[model samples]
Target: MIKNEKIKATEVQLTGLNGEDLGIMSTRDALALAKQHKVDLICMSLMTSPPPCKLMGAGAAKQEKQQEKKKAAKTPDKRKVKEIRLNLQMEDHDRETKQSQAERILTKGDSVKLVIQVHGAKEGTAGKEWAEQLCKSLAEYGSKTTGIQVSGKQVVVQLDPIE
Candidate 1:
């Protein structure tokens, strides 16, 4: 936006800092008025007849409008598969707490992958069983999104939030 001599329009529709109209006047006169108001004369829309202008300063409302525009452009996180690992030795309460955490993640429209990692000789079979049990318990919050799979000592189960 141009101020004073920089403005091409001979006359402009002036709006005060408080959003009050200051009537149509020459760009120079509008600039003088803005000077009196201790603000900058900014031409808002210049293509139309008698271009519209505003009195702006450090407290210009345009700043807030720009801030709001920036805020509106933000987007929510895109859906991604989240992982929640479990221990074969976890107590019942610990297992329930982890399942609750998975529920919270599912509620946000993200898939949850439950992994039971064990370090013992029976961990392969035992981990898969534990993973299956966790998926069954999570039925109220979500549905199994993927089949449980066992790889080495780890068993994985994925669940999606109910639509």
Candidate 2:
């Protein structure tokens, strides 16, 4: 958007600040007309024959563009990966609560990760097996994205929704 004396074109199709066409004119005259309206002479299309130039406030044009960008960010994507944490010694009721929460998350077409952390010295096969059983019960909602895996003190399971 070269302006005024900075425009290399000898002549251009000129449009007034109020969007009225002033026809094709020399760059010098276009600058004079733009100055009369207290706006900048902007070269809009440099590639066209007799490039089109318009008289507009650069700040206003930039501000409008920024506002358009902001509007695009307001939309939301519902797909997400949610986590449900469990402990090796969690009570049965607490496990039921987490299962219900996972159901809700999957109902929204999202995925869930079930994590179980063993706290006591008995950080062995028992904790991982329990966590696997919980994950398997959720098969009514969807299939497991991965096989249950066990670390030294934690177990992780991933499930994706049917959709």
Candidate 3:
């Protein structure tokens, strides 16, 4: 439906083709006026005692309404999660690259998940320390906008949006 489709006032005020008021009249008179103008009698408001309506080209009005609906539907909501993965033993260059990727994702209005997976016997104290260092580096380089948490063998960091 058109935005604020309802018309206000009891005098059955009509609007011209350029949206100027065409004065008040009875329902029958308005219908006759619409017929004379070769347009449709559209009931815009039913709140008043006699209700208020409009006289306009039905096809053009419907097309405008559909266009507005499509415009509203195309707008994107901002609260969506986007995920990125990393390994516990990722090299300095690879970690930097992944961090850049996460930054890009956050810039696009998405939350990023930085996952670090640990494997085998190498998943010892050194591995944990390495994970912590990586997390710290990511936080420092990414301006600490990310939320970090540890879950067993995985170190997950959620990157916040830029401003």
Best by TM-score: 2
lDDT: which candidate is best? 1
Q: TM-score for every candidate vs. truth?
A: 0.50, 0.51, 0.49
lDDT string for model 2 (1-108, tens) is 477789998899998877888899998988887788788888877789799988889896677558877888777665688988888677889989989999888888
Candidate 3 per-residue lDDT over residues 1-163, each given as its tens digit: 3212233332475666667777677666776777788886666555665554567798877986799889999997765776777776678899789768876766666766667776654564444565456556555333334445555677665655555
Ranking the candidates on lDDT from highest down gives 1, 2, 3
Per-model lDDT: 0.83, 0.82, 0.63
Q: What lDDT score goes with residue 87 in model 3?
A: 78
In model 2, which regions exceed 4 Å deviation? 1-78, 119-122
Better of 1 and 2 by lDDT: 1
Q: How accurate is candidate 3 locally (lDDT)?
A: 0.63
Window of ten residues with lowest summed lDDT in model 1: 58-67
Q: TM-score of the candidate numbered 1?
A: 0.50
Candidate 1 structure quality by residue, lDDT tens digits, 82-114: 999898888989988998899899888899998
Q: How many clashing pairs in candidate 3?
A: 0
